[model samples]
Target: MTTFGSQSDVIAFLSEPSAYGVSDLVKRIDTHAAIIFLAGDRAYKLKRAVRYPYLDFSSAEKRRLVCKAELALNRRTAPDLYLEVCSIGRLDDGSLALGQGSPVDWLIVMRRFAAKDLLDAMAREGRLEPKLLRELADGISRFHELAEIETHHDAVGRVRSVIEGNRVSMAKLPGMPLAACDRARLFTSSLVLLDQLTPLLARRGEAGLVRHCHGDLHLGNICMWQGKPVLFDCLEFDAGLATSDLLYDLAFLLMDLWQRGLRDEASLVFNRYCDRRAETDGLAAMPLFLSMRAAVRAHVEARGSDLQPDVKGRKDKLVTARRYLASAVGFLDRPEPRLLAVGGLSGSGKSTLAARLAPRIGTAPGVRLLRTDMLRKRLAGVDPEAHLPESAYTRETHDAVYAALLEEARKTLDAGWPVIVDAVFDFPATRAQVEALARAVAVPFSGLWLDAPRDLLHARVGTRRGDASDAGPAVVDKQLERDVGFLGDWQCVDARGDAQQTLEHAIAALGSECPIG
Candidate 1:
């Protein structure tokens, strides 16, 4: 049995540095549901004894259980950061102490990390590097792969519930800043998208795509730990809220990045995650997922606005909530899907152009980039940057890679997302096959064949390091010897200059079809 105690006493005890036997000052951070005290090298998180519609921590036992649950859940991705759950209770002589006498509340102890190490802080400071983003996406993919699959969820109903909840909350928010018509449109459009995606959601659930996932996978919840991104603060109060389609889980981060004007970073994370997970078919639901995630944020901010201590802080929060509301509406207005193929011999800067162009092509995070080299590596069950043997580059293997690339492009197109297939589509058959996929999918198609001097190509391939492509100078020589078929309808771009110049030419060739921001 647990005994209820005063929260102020617990807070005062945790706020004192001497409580941890440390001389350093203790810092405190608060949220609606919890309070964290940072002392020395550790953080103590205590659940607030409050009851909400979504969760209950009104009892000492409830708080203790939730504290234990949070520790267990977070340890899955951040084992080193989470230590143990500690009980706060009254000691002899009626003094509050940790793990001492009659238990009153519980707290999760965690290793303290620098505030600057948080991804959100890094994003605000323009320190989010591409390498870090890629690694983070890969880490997320691996985590999702190992998450327990959920089979009993009414996946569609769950999503529908979120949509309806957002609608209700947005409409009834205190000092609702949004116009009535705008709120109506947001709900109406989101519900319409939900109706259209109901079947796909159910099918994905049947396919075991739904799973227990980090319910709150935002940048703020991720931090740099031991030179890598570590996910923490997973939603532990409610399993029903935490379980979702993995793509839906990922959309929270993607939407977060996009909302922060980190479109390029968002695109990189999205593409890398797709490369790692191959969740291309779920792209159709992305608009809905992204919208719902933003809607959730909007309402959360709106509700949090009321808790602000000052008028200016309250107004600032409402302003942010409305901005998120607008973004939520925009996410649902997905553009028409398109297919683009970037083909060249090794060192023609085809991959470079594809990457630069993808973020600006369509929608928030842009196109799914499919590179044959990466595909080949994936086929061999190796990391994307791992080098392969010459045997892996056989004609049969090349054909198989092209086949797989086209199939993936087709699927991504069917999912109503733009795709850019990067490959050496030199042979007529390979070129025609990719072009045929666009026609089959009824999406606009464009092909850019990069033409660079043989010397430049040789120089490019010779100096390559940590690249997925195994092509060297010898491979470049062989490619130069083979006569590339007529350019046909594919636009030719001069790649002799630097990558930017080549991208400029390709974008010019793409013209109105490829919308650049």
Candidate 2:
């Protein structure tokens, strides 16, 4: 039986165009554990013959099993990308061949996609659009819904192990980029937060929030394929590492986006995902989740520095590692969250102002928005854009919708995330309800009342299409006839002008009360 001497020989074989039965050039992409060779329309991923504390692929049989596992697991999300696991054997002439000779190694075949389609590349080029992020969030939420829940898994123990692993990995790095004091503080603060959240974490595990997730969820592992974002390259070698709380899995992507200076995009994704899943109660764990995700990247970058061939590349990676380390500390110690409410008649630009201000309200991804229109749709079990009958607008339904909004806002605020409530609040009771909630939660609250000409309101709502709001000119007329009780402490902002002007006016009025950037 012909056997390859080392992984280098296998890499060399795969690096040639003849290996892929194509005349085109072959390109190689290397990572710590796998080498991917791209030729023509196909890509082959070969696992390295290396043994690490967390993973072992030292034997050919082990590599084969891992390759099969990867293909099976990744096909869950990226079915079009993962093809099959092929055996690499030898020919009669002692030459290497695929699926023909005595097995020496194995490779996972995948469909090659354009590098520019990678979400990381799109972010670097400022090509990540709002529509794309919304769709991506929807897809992620659906994926989490389908993930297998591990009822018997110890969620606390798993997180503690990760924290300990991070500690050991970072401490062992030669010439560690982080200060010893800072590293110790990060770990201590993370542990304290974990202790505080143990009960809630245990409840979430019991409620089946912990599942087998896409362990390595980040921009680099996602790509735009067939006009949508597809998640691939999941952590397959270790099932324990791949299984965790669904929110923790999502926190990796949120941390990645925030660290890339895409705060608005990050906030949009967060709000969209929460709207789909009603995951507001879990917001309390975001700080710890975000911090741990950042810490994971910090050590990973530091470890990558050791593999850099050049001094400059190694130094750059170390610098990046230090930056990520600092971010980890920052995420764990964010400022207190505030509660902002926008009240106005239908079509008075409250929704626009709330969306614009959300990213600047509090921490990295900003706040959760609780809009009456969206809540009504969610309560009715319909899509946000679906039209509702007039019966859905009864006084009882209105009261129910407002009650749901206030409850969600209270839950989100108590979870240490800022909130923006968008509703008419045309009655004294509804207005008092939200204000009382802020007082009960002991959070800083600011309410903005939008004022606009009746004609302007009519014109705005008349042109609406495919919006979550179902307000029309007739609805605006009804709101105008209704007496919205005295404004009290709420500030009035002029919405007669364009959306930007209204946003600026609202921000100016909130300057003293809200800590918006």
Candidate 3:
């Protein structure tokens, strides 16, 4: 054993594979606050001996505590990834050894997975399938449900702090690309919006909606582990940062996907999570949540430019930072509210079209997709894939579902957010009711009736798996027998072909009526 007494010695010891009893090849990755060393099947994360305004790891004791905290917090979502916190200690022979003697440094040991399995890498490689995204959304929703609710903090105050922090940080940045006027406008708009939502935020907090969540929920922090999406590397330094409205936590991933130009994927995750959680009421606050998330990323990226070693790297970071700022501003620039109803048979692609059109339709994070299947499942207190008995689809139950959908749409439109209803309006009364609901609210309404061949509809329903809609081939057959009387002025979308073609046709038919795209 070699004698060591300094930080450089500890680093040198860890840099060698012999220290880990593994291959000679050691991979090192550095972040602003931590250094990760990957050796063979295990990875060790050591916090940098640095202090920032938001975090401090300057002391060995503090680093050890944070390492333990990180293990505990991240284990909530990724128990398999975070193994344990190990101490790098001075052995009896005076050499630094992992898990051997008196502590000199701390590291969080983890089970290393392939880097290509990261959601960000999958997305970049175009391997991020819709099924995987749906699974990820469900995983996040479940995590939020089980997260501890924070009762001590004021939700509004937390958001206000973030808004103020972004402003102050940007102001302090030297040669920031964002204009002062632009920053002022965003700050003012955010404050105004916060003022309007204060009561709602308080009510949600009181209702236990504010939870200790995964603060940094971007795609990069998620990865495929054991054939499932596992969330790891959660914010652990600041409890205040991690404790927030669940939707606000969700907005980080949404903003990341939107910035990556994956609008459809972003919309799917949003709608899927909303469906699983039944969180339509919070849609009004999403724009602010998304803007705040973007702003946080902006200033963080801008600050990152200062940490870069070269001019080119700094310039690239600055450009990314500016784009994030622009995205933050763009999130607040909402369009006029409108109501879109996509009605057809069970497998006529109503839900598919609604999901596809949602991201293009309204404000930043897209319109509220109110699907009847999800509503029925929620009302029945069953999982979306849980089969519903025949009694569950009675006429009375059907009326109740439609009424709930209409009421939700009304509230969404009142909040100045667009909505898309996905349901089977086989009856003239139901179709008329939907049209009247939009008219009563005095918002532009577009009714799209998707028509497809019977065989395709039956086949589509037959192959359904893990879908909210429990409708089968028998249900499609029953729908085919129903007489759907004249859908006056409703745009008939021929959804007999592939999904993309059907979406294009529907968008073209709606044209200026649907000003979303």
Candidate 4:
């Protein structure tokens, strides 16, 4: 293998398209640490000869090692994209060649795809469907399940490090957009949140929640490939950056969606992922995690402003950076916790309303939706979509499910997070119990009962697919015969209308009870 004395020689050699056995046309994209050369249908990534406080790729050996790491780590999520690491070398006649001669520098070869297929691009084009969002959440959940748990990494310590790093980075900015008072307030609030969540973070880490995950999980790092959302470009330079609590890893994507005004999509992803992982307890840490993620983006964007060559570009980036900082502060501002119950018979759209309202009910990342159907399924030790035997819905099982919901709600409320209970609540006793539970907790409580005609309920139930509720038309017919106690002070929402209209009616009924818009 040929060795080049300087990085310039290697760059000069790779600039020639003939070395890659492709046409003369070459497209190059440069980042802080790497230069990606796209030729034909393949791309070659070469680590730049650079050294930073967090990373070092100054030497050929270091570059080669990082290139290998990039290839290996990326293959875990995007096997089809990361091809292999090849060598860039000089020939005997002082010419450059790929995969031949003495190895001068390492290049990561990858199969290239269209940039417009990225999730961020889809979101910008308004092509981001709910189905795609759910699929993305599912894919991320599966990856987290299979990710290697890092036993040595302390979750709380990692979060502390991130907070400290953000502080240091923001302090280093030449002209920070935030006022001194605002900066101090945001920092203090963030620290307070971190202090409050230290115990939960430690417990989560001890429970093996700390895993080697996709550190950069924003929409830009994901793309629609092969009709599926494939995650790539993970943080391969530093293991410390990549290893953390799984929820914190997910916060990056959540923060991205929230900042982009995709609030519903962000909430949907959060709930779907939590449902798949059965990780509702982590919701308490979401505000801190999301704030940290936003702070990170803010500082990064602020630093990017300095890197821009033009005044207008720098000003625009500064504006974006300030907005991210504001979002970070907003995340830290906790809202008043309240308990909400949405009750109805099968196919009355109670669950749909719960799902839609949960994200907008309280603080960052929304409320914990405690659905009795899901609790019942969990109690039965069956899949959520699994149909339980008729015996499973007996009075004893029913009471057990309600008890479980109450217990969970208590814990969630005790943790200072809002909760939304979705259940049939057909019996007067059940309704009274929920109201009493909220009173006992001393939180503002609102109960919403959905009403729809029998025929409409039956039609809606008949179309149920892969949902947590096992209720079918037969179940709806039986529920029609049950006596639902007096409405009392609870609000009634017309469920026969479309979902958006129903949501509007629910919000209207909520009025001042719902503080978050």
Candidate 5:
């Protein structure tokens, strides 16, 4: 239906690789989208020049809508990368110049990023770092804080329209498995609960949680920009698709992480986001979203093989989509969690474990981590790294801060969310309080008391920097002398040697999302 390489000028530039050493510059397409090379620095995206029930990529106004949606969403974390949408023109001499006439076509120009820095490659080479995931978690939380929420659309109206459309697509597929039908139905029921949560969903939009978001987030769309994570290639063709739950938006990337088989890294990313956000109220939003993403993938595959007669060739992708849909259904079945808590003496890698173990649990998008030091500082109206006198650690301050942490945990868990509570819980009273709360809430809880040779702790603490926990080498002696009360509810994990090695052992104990007996 379309002719690529027909434009000789464009073809020549692509075929003759430039200085950045780009080679694979042909073209790629899905049912609704297509991408073409415009030099190594940018790519031009054009809608399939078709209209559908869910998306109208036909008229000029429709094309403009997509362009605006993509530009706004991508500006969230990668403003510098996505330049603009320019008008394409057919000149009098019959040539195409960007931004030239009455706009014969529309395109999104984005700065190109390297492929090898992707999480998939990083996972394959075993080069993913907890610190990087931690930073990425922080970055995403910041983006959510600034996003615009959906005000006009009810949760059911917004969500079901997309889900049900996928059901239609699944039905149209060559031979969708029976399991997929079951999964779509489960996802449908979950949307029923979502309808009840519409008011809250709208409140979140009012609170600015829903903004135009990078609609198609995956490892390939994210890159390390100046040692920071930058998201690009946002959904440019559909505002309705882009305006949805923050968790739903995040699920796409999380799904990509799992698909890449970086389960540990996925868990770390999940927990890290949760820790920073503590948006436990959004927990119920996960199933609805995760299912929708899986549905999207299902429809995507069905659409990909729409006219390709090789029915056998598409079976593998169909099966993959079917499994993902079932997984979405499984989350709706409410699998009970085995809560694994990461705790330790100051600077003993407890935070690291919490960050890494989260994405490994469910197909959940991101993790939530609760840091005592940061919470304590916030309670006292001070910056995380601000000097806290010994008075700040008094009995009254400790009680209030811990109470807040416990309350946060309740809120986080009640929302069906996972979190890493970063605290010493050194005193038996503190440890016991956490255990009792978890039992009262009926949430699975695990306590890991992280430790190191006292000398190692001393050395690490002596040189710690840029963190809020005020416990230094000077405080280590006081901590050591203090009664490390009640060791009953916790397991002691050695936090010695290199930090990464310590994390490897902890991840093994946590097991993969699909735990084997």
Candidate 6:
């Protein structure tokens, strides 16, 4: 190993990185994160002493902790790729040999795979498969489900802190594009939106989507190991940053694909995720998150552009800033107009019918379906799959939930987009409240009530899976005690006659005034 003491001495890294394989070094990269060197069939990762606000690997123990976090988190998302964390220290002779010897620094040793096979490379080489995207979604969803979620207060603090910290990144950085300056201004102007998002924190806390995620879930961080997708290099340093709303983490990739002009693939990935994990409270957070991620992208690209030598690279980076800005602005553009509310007692077929009828209505290319189970779970500040105590069903909590549903309905309809609100809307107050949102937006509001005898509703709830809702036979019985059936001049559909037949009726009801042109 060569002895180096200063920044210039680190020049050896550029040549040494490819010392593993010349071909690997010839490909690409320019981040102060880690350097890749191959030893046998394994890749040895050495962290840089860069201490950005969002992460810090500037010290020996800090690097070790971060490396361990990376190993543990990546193992969940890409189990085959992350082998183990190898502590690096000086040996008796004062040289580093990973864990074989001892004592200078810490390095994460990973199994080496072909660099050409990373998801980014595959996309560039026109070799990405549809199945690969689907698998990626599945892996991420499962990983998220298993990851630990922070408590509600910590979750909110972590997220807001990231935003505040990024401001520090903006100020201290030497190179920021003019467009980036404009973007910072735009976001500063939009800070009022934070008030809208602030109230949501309580609801989201209850729903419980705040988990430790693959902090850097971009295309470049994913690869195929043994013919399956493997995610790597997750952030390990900042628990606050990693512990956040799941949709905020997901928006990085979705925004990446959308920014890259790969809308079709983006849609495929998004649809696959929705189909598998099926959480809807994120719908409210996603657009807001998409904007933030795009803003981050603008800053990262613009700041990094300072290292480029050519004028074109500089202009291209500015263009990237514009692209991200446009994406953020697009969220507020004309949203489709229609309200589709799905109601029935728990297990009365509301979800199934709404899921089926959604595609037939809405503004064709897209329609948002907002579900109470997801929103309520998020509001509870707990994972959607975790069971809350029985006391969580207090009347106050139910009222807060309906208030959230009404809020979601208003925001969604105002966006000029068709939406499906999936909740019992059992209370007259709740139904009338949300219907008013549709009327205020001057949009036609439609409601579909899925009905079944109490017996079947009980059966469906007892057999549910991977869902965090508290509705069951007991909840249904309690509702029955309070008269939980449709009472106003609202559309009602029989859900007892087979879910398929019930779905058809709902679909027919929706198609009569399909939102899609």
TM match of model 4 to true structure: 0.91
Per-residue lDDT tens digits of candidate 6, residues 27-73? 33455466665655777777766665556666667778888877877
The alpha-carbon lDDT assigned to residue 34 of candidate 1 equals 80
lDDT of 5 at 124: 67
lDDT comparing candidate 2 with the true structure: 0.88
lDDT of each: 0.88, 0.88, 0.88, 0.84, 0.66, 0.67
Q: Report the C-alpha lDDT of model 5 over 1-517, residue by residue, as the tens digit.
A: 2222233443333334451256655443333355455455666665445555455666656666788777776777788887888776667886556676566656677776666676556666777776677777678777777876566755446666777776666666545553655855765677776676676666666665666666787776667877877766777666777777777788877766665566776666765565566567776576567666766775675555544457675666566666666665654543343345577777686766665555545445444567788788778876556779987888899889989888888787776765567788888888888888789788777777888877888888787776677888767777788878768847777789576787766655544532322
Residue 293 lDDT, candidate 4, scale 0-100: 90
- TM-score of every model versus the real structure: 0.95, 0.95, 0.94, 0.91, 0.79, 0.63
Candidate 1 vs candidate 6: the lDDT winner is: 1
Q: What tens-digit string does per-residue lDDT give for candidate 3 at 15-123?
A: 9999999876899887767778999999999887876556777789988888888999999999989999999999889988999899999999999999999999998
- Across 322-419, the per-residue lDDT of candidate 4 in tens digits comes to 88888888888775767899999999999999988987877667787888998888788776678887878898999999998888888778777898
Misplaced by over 4 Å in model 2 are: 1-5
For model 1 the TM-score comes to: 0.95
- Which lDDT tens digits does candidate 1 get at residues 1-517? 1213458888888888878899989998877678889988899998887765466888888888888888889988999999999988888888888888989789899999999999999999999998899899999999999998997989999898878877776777656666677778888998899899889999999999889999999999999999999999999998888999999999999999999999889988999999998777889999889998998888788777766889999899888988998888899987578888999999999988888888888887788999999899899999988888898889999999999998888888888888999999989989989888888889888889999998899888888876788899888888888888787889999999998899899989988876777
| Model 1 lDDT, residue 301, Cα | 83
Off by over 4 Å in 5: 1-32, 59-61, 117-127, 174-180, 183-185, 188-208, 305-316, 337-343, 347-349, 352-369, 377-395, 417-420, 443-452, 462-470, 486-517
Which lDDT value does model 4 have at 195? 88
